[model samples]
Target chain A: MAKSKTHVSHRQYDDEESGWACMNWFEYMLVVVLASLLLLGALTLTLFWALYYAGGFAWTEEPARQFNLHPVLMVAGFITFSGFSLLLYRICRCCRRIYVKLFHTIFHALAIPCIVVGFIAVLDSHNLADPPIANFYSLHSWMGLVTMGLFALQFVVGFFSFLILLCCEGATAAFRASLVPIHASFGITTFMLAVATCLTGLTEKAFFKLSSKYSEMPEEGIIMNALAMVLVALGILLSYAVRREPFRTQVKTFVTERL
Target chain B: MAKSKTHVSHRQYDDEESGWACMNWFEYMLVVVLASLLLLGALTLTLFWALYYAGGFAWTEEPARQFNLHPVLMVAGFITFSGFSLLLYRICRCCRRIYVKLFHTIFHALAIPCIVVGFIAVLDSHNLADPPIANFYSLHSWMGLVTMGLFALQFVVGFFSFLILLCCEGATAAFRASLVPIHASFGITTFMLAVATCLTGLTEKAFFKLSSKYSEMPEEGIIMNALAMVLVALGILLSYAVRREPFRTQVKTFVTERL
Candidate 1:
């Protein structure tokens, strides 16, 4: 975590170097949008877990309880943490490059454990079921596993390219620059996949658990649908904000003017 | 459809484009990747439909037969067509700007009806059911409606901005240029959502049909999983190819040099 003298702060490229001093309405609104999404996504996911527990949650060799952990951990690791990491560059636009990079790395580092634990929960649920519910049988399981694999791959590549490779003497500026868009594309894609997994997984669970009771869509079903919408909205907003080049280009304009 | 003399061919921008003569291995591979995805995607979807029929398709006011149309039309309209439209800028890199523009516009124009027909199938299935299956109840349904809305909005805005506004004298070159990235972003995002819809929908159907019969891994279940992987792979490849900047930047270099 030691600061290197040669490391230029990303904020140094800001249109103004006064440290978040100049604020625009568009930037403020984007922040508001991201914050609302994170808040709503987390709140709804917690509510879902609460509802599951209220309905009946347990831990002792109970397949249902083990299964319940799947959604909770996934939302925590995959959705929330991943969402934060996606926004880190924008959120920390005023910070030094290394700090932003570290924060982004830390958030993703936290996400992996949660995702692994969630996958384990999924496996445990199937294995523990009385009749042994089949694992990896449905498209949901296939997509979930793929999403996790892509996520882990992204994290490893990103860690090496962005964090480690940058320090190597042989690392050219062009190579570092080239990795940006690829890293970003992978990040956005993986985040969207996580959202997709949540939607599909929830849909599968809803049909299995509530479709019979709420064939006409009782309150619980409605909540699940709403949760999915919030997740989708988050994904859309995150992608839009991430793709905004004007903000980053604005930083370059300042550096040019200063020179 | 009249050709504009002012619009130069995109090929001229190629890193010293004499013609299609400067082909590279990377570009060729990208084309191969895209073609394989499109081929595999269409083939698998047709195979899935065929499997459903082979398993015994019903059309007699039976919700199943009507529901069958949903996947076919969706794959036709949303997945295959939308994906092609997304890649038009890349695939048509050799064409003049206006021609590429028109093709992109026309392809999206064609996708609308297919999507509408697909939605109708969804409605018919729900309505024609004996007790009447509820509509827009599941997370998949919610996401589908939302994706449709976003796609329609993108189409409207793109049609006006790219085609209509460009005809007006007051429209600046900078304005048209700005719309390009936004249009591209929405196009890619919407296409990814369509793929996600296919994945979630297939998961729902497979679980309902095969999970019970082949709870321990049936042949049909494996086919469904394979279909989902193909869809996910297609989404990733499409996004990667679309985000590629070298292909587009090569065009701009020619413009800059001429100016």
Candidate 2:
């Protein structure tokens, strides 16, 4: 009977008060961290597309044109992600959102291991490898793919869900004011643009493999390159070109007000 | 006895636990937010600098270059700062030290706003000003100077302090291992590079004022423009070349370890 009473009290605490596993603040922060991480991840992937897949990747060739590009983009991308994760911690630091804290702790810890492994794979592929091929593709590629995929899905889906719920019920004023569509659009666009670019990357990597085998850029290689360029160009335009007059104002206003 | 015991207990809590203001996680976040806001406030000064010290001023002449450029760069700069802010936040998210969070928040937040404002001013002045400037000392030019000055100070003073503490702890194995020199070098070089480039901006604005009054390039305008190009070329080299090696290593090591 004593045990039952203690368990009941604890259960009530979990349900009605902040606990380690469930709370509003925790959940909200979890979403923020996830969103930022997703952006960082997308940035990294986009860079990889630019450096390795976009025609400049000679890891083994003396003066490998294939792999020389701006190192800051990738470096800054990770740093940005790390910063966002910190923001998440701060957001929950003030509140007692046990569930978010738990989520934050578990996911970040798990993410650390993944990030470490991915980084090692990248280092090995770049510095240690003899080079024509960095042996970077197998697990390194897929591990990154999965990690990025998880972040992308979590951020987009979470935001979309929150937005829909807000619209359906007319979310509280504080909550309503917080919804930012431009930021969200930037988030989602960065992710989707990354994916579209990645597809082009796969095609380019194959072309590199084929061209290396033949010792020449084949007819198909040239065609694929042009196709890839077009896709990336379109993506860049979409990402940056929205800054013009009337449309920019409408989009910004809607996004700020709605979110 | 009861009153004395209660007084002692309250004192103990004060010592052991952070109060709402000084050292709690929430307060730490508040400091960071406060710093970020300060950085934003600092940007307003940039605008005033241009107005007081710059050369030509005619927003009506270049609507697209004027207002469009302002907000576009503002948005871009903000995005950039936010991205880095997120990374910094992630790094120390779990840190419990009072001084660590306090100083870290202060420096990182303060540094970026200056950079963002300067960047926007420079970019806007060059591209958005519509009609090419006959001088380099306009409202925009002065704003750029302020931004540059604040950025330099923030990087050298606040950044070094933040990094000193960081290196002392040697927390992340990788952070301690190789990031030190690269981190420190960028701290100095970015500033020097900015100084070299920003002067030409002032010259350009000055020419604009003279051009507006006299309707022609001053004798010095031609020389100043040439110097501007040279400075710009050097700045590019500094950014892309000198910064690249450390940045590359940092990027690789960072991505490899932290992801």
Q: Pick the candidate with the highest lDDT.
A: 1
Give the per-residue Cα lDDT of candidate 2 at B155. 51
**Candidate 1 ranges with C-alpha deviation above 4 Å:** A1-25, A31-36, A51-61, A169-172, A250-259, B1-25, B31-36, B51-63, B169-174, B251-259
C-alpha local distance difference test of each model: 0.71, 0.39
Residue B188's lDDT in candidate 2: 29
What is candidate 1's lDDT per residue for B143-184, written digit by digit as tens? Answer: 899889989999998888777776673544566666666676
B141: Cα error in model 1, Å: 1.4
Best by TM-score: 1
- Scored against the true structure, residue B91 in model 2 reaches a CA lDDT of 34
Q: In angstroms, how far off is A133's CA in candidate 1?
A: 1.6
Model 1 chain B, poorest ten-residue lDDT window? B250-259
The pairs that clash in candidate 1 are: none
Q: Per-residue lDDT of B189-246 in model 2, one digit per residue for the tens? A: 3332232223323333333344333224444434333333333323222223222322
Model 2's TM-score against the true structure: 0.26
